[model samples]
Target: MARPRRIVLLRHGESVGNVDDTVYEREPDHALALTAKGRSQAEDAGRALRAVFDGERISAYVSPYRRTHQTFQSLGLDPAKVRVREEPRLREQDWGNWQDRDDVRRQKAYRDAYGHFFYRFAQGESGADVYDRVGAFLESLWRSFEDPHHPPNVLIVTHGLTMRLFCMRWFHWTVAEFESLSNPDNAEWRTLLLGPDGRYSLDRPFDRWCEPESYGVTG
Candidate 1:
């Protein structure tokens, strides 16, 4: 498959749920809206992206979640030039039932002690499940790359975990390597540039939780 000139992976700005975990307990994840600060952040991100592209046309794949959609809308890109599509697979990890504060704290502690990759929420999904969906998404992306009409540059607006899982699947990283990586900050983006060799490489470094001396183990 012919790679796109560049792939920009962006996390949605802070949502209402980001400011208050309890909001997740009260509202569905898909319905959560962005906060005022989140809106500002999204605008800033859009400006930054515009500066990076320098008036080039790009395609956007946005998560179906309200916050993600809102973020894309806030980007201020030329709608006539940029094609936008909703991608369900780009949604955030399902958390199932609305969680209580105690449950949320307990689960965090357990996941920290054990592992985030394998931890499954009650009636929800594990990181492995997300990885599976991300892998499938990549397959679809590759097919798009083969299309002559596909855009040369692509933008993805998704969740932090989704972004991480996409990178993991794209790079074929092991669980240990995945564990070492940290999620990008809200409204932050990472770029993958296709090189002359026809392979894509990350443009920046990520924070590593696990050091080289302690591979496969938490620091």
Candidate 2:
């Protein structure tokens, strides 16, 4: 039987990492709060989403990170209407042992070895690592949808790597193809529609400016 429809996805308005890029970050990493620009970006994202969904019920979930929580706060979603649940599985890739490294030589060497995030750092997890975790998360989410009362519209806030990996599976993109997707900007969300037939489709990312008139959805 076709399952009930649902929407699950990442949050908007958080930077790639802590500004001190030289640091070798560890799991439960350092703070990477959204900039002022990021907050504005998130607001716009919220506006766009509200326009699309209108009065549809939304079940919202967020990673246990300050940036993600703050992003939603900026959106001004009512706490009563949108219950925020935190999940560690939704957290960023734990970049262990790669924190606080001021050594340009080592950093450059590591970057070269990994080829732009292909390598698992000394104490860090790999993209594949995150993919595994998120995969399980998705599986559990689907199980809940099996319930007749599950909400039709859902939202999730997560990091770039996680989003990339999850979307890769949905779109049937290879590693290279997934890597080719634009790195989502802070406060830019990607929306997906999951059909009862178990098919996933991309809606739009938060960073992209979307006009209601453009989509012809009149409020």
- How would you encode candidate 1's per-residue C-alpha lDDT over 55-168 as one tens digit per residue? 776889999999999999888988876888899988888878677867878887888777778998877888989999988888888888887777778999999988988988
Q: After superposition, how far is residue 21 of candidate 1 from its true place, in Å?
A: 0.9
TM-score of candidate 2 relative to the true fold: 0.76
Candidate 1 at 107: error in angstroms? 1.1
Residue 188's lDDT within candidate 2 is 57
Q: TM-scores, in order shown?
A: 0.93, 0.76
The candidate that wins on lDDT is: 1
Candidate 2 error regions (>4 Å): 1-8, 15-30, 103-118, 194-198, 204-219
lDDT of 2 by residue, 145-193 (tens): 7767665577888777677777765565555554445557566567787
C-alpha RMSD for every candidate: 2.5, 8.1
